[model samples]
Target: MIDIVTVDTPHPYPPRISAFTRPFWEALAEGRLLTTRSVATRALTFPPKPISPADWTTEVEWVELSGSGVLYSHTTIHAAPTAFVGDLPYRVAIIDLDEGIRLATRHIGEIAPVIGAPVDLVAVRHTDAVSFAARSRA
Candidate 1:
């Protein structure tokens, strides 16, 4: 089982919400994964866009991801952004989701993660925004 850490300090920089990204934020708020896929090419894209990157078509739709992925890479950050200064030595990981899309998210486990290890999505709420973390799949 994976553990979730709780910090008293909140994130300094909250996420900026806009119409284009509203659906994503809503899904994250509900602890679910939301992404976009091209109707023509069926290519998936993160940060959901109106137009498909694979094909220059405006045909896209919102799709729910499984939230299960493999930890492709990760890094420990002693130096962090102003908002994340309080949380030093935090782990940021790049996860390759089962949907075939890669998401760079925070790792929310006690120990360092292994490359190619399975990970699952965990929604973390701060004072200002909701962020996603990758935890051990097991």
Candidate 2:
């Protein structure tokens, strides 16, 4: 198994915050993860949509995520983007959350990333922001 890695660095860019997405960023700053569930169809979504993507008529309600998931896929990056050159050979992963939403995130854990490995969401605190990373449950 390859050793997973972690990095502590300042987030380079600020996200565009719309009124609908503000709550999501606010929750991240406080080390909490939130998603939206459709008021009509009861489907869960990440990034906190103001309305359900499934059915436009449905308004959504904010819900907290347990930060648990399984690693669906991943890749190791060696090509350096100007902003992330310092963090070469980083692993980015797609996770399938227990809540049924899928999100792409950095993989951070002692165990190597393998397809179907159980993982937990972890908050990566930057200088003035927070992002998510996934840790292997094993």
Candidate 3:
């Protein structure tokens, strides 16, 4: 049986919004992946840039992203964030998606985090969401 850590109580953070990140936040609310596209060169970018960093063009556009990725790096956190009190000692990781974007998020599920492990994005909830789980190797 796989081990599961249950959070009895979870602290909350007041949601904050920013102009460049609005689309991403909104998409997450609707269970959709959101990324940015460079306006000048029409290149795809993650973390949603308002302008193309390469050429300083304001042609950044929002795009949907597939959530498949692989674990790049990870750590077990003993101290939780102030807003995540009950979830102390959680596993956090940097997942490198197939599109070559790397995102930092809490890693979940039964197995321990490992470098180069296959992972997939699963929406846990609206607020507490978007985590990666180690893919089972048969």
Per-residue lDDT of candidate 2, residues 110-137 (tens digit): 7899899888887666765666688887
lDDT of 3 at 57: 83
Choose 1 or 2, whichever is better by lDDT.
Answer: 1
Error of 3 at 116 (Å): 0.9
**For candidate 2, which ten residues in a row score worst on lDDT?**
1-10
Candidate 1 residues lying further than 4 Å off, grouped into runs, are 1-9
Give the total clashing residue pairs for model 2: 0
**lDDT accuracy of residue 73 in candidate 3:** 90
- Per-model C-alpha lDDT, please? 0.80, 0.78, 0.65
Segments in model 3 whose C-alpha atoms lie over 4 Å from true places: 1-11, 126-138
lDDT of 2: 0.78
- Tens digit per residue, CA lDDT, model 3, 21-138: 8777666555567788886677777667877776788867787777777888988888776777666777878888877788887787677767887877654443343222333222
lDDT winner between 1 and 3, please give it.
1
Clash count of each predicted structure: 0, 0, 1
Task: Report the alpha-carbon TM-score of model 1 versus the true structure.
Answer: 0.88
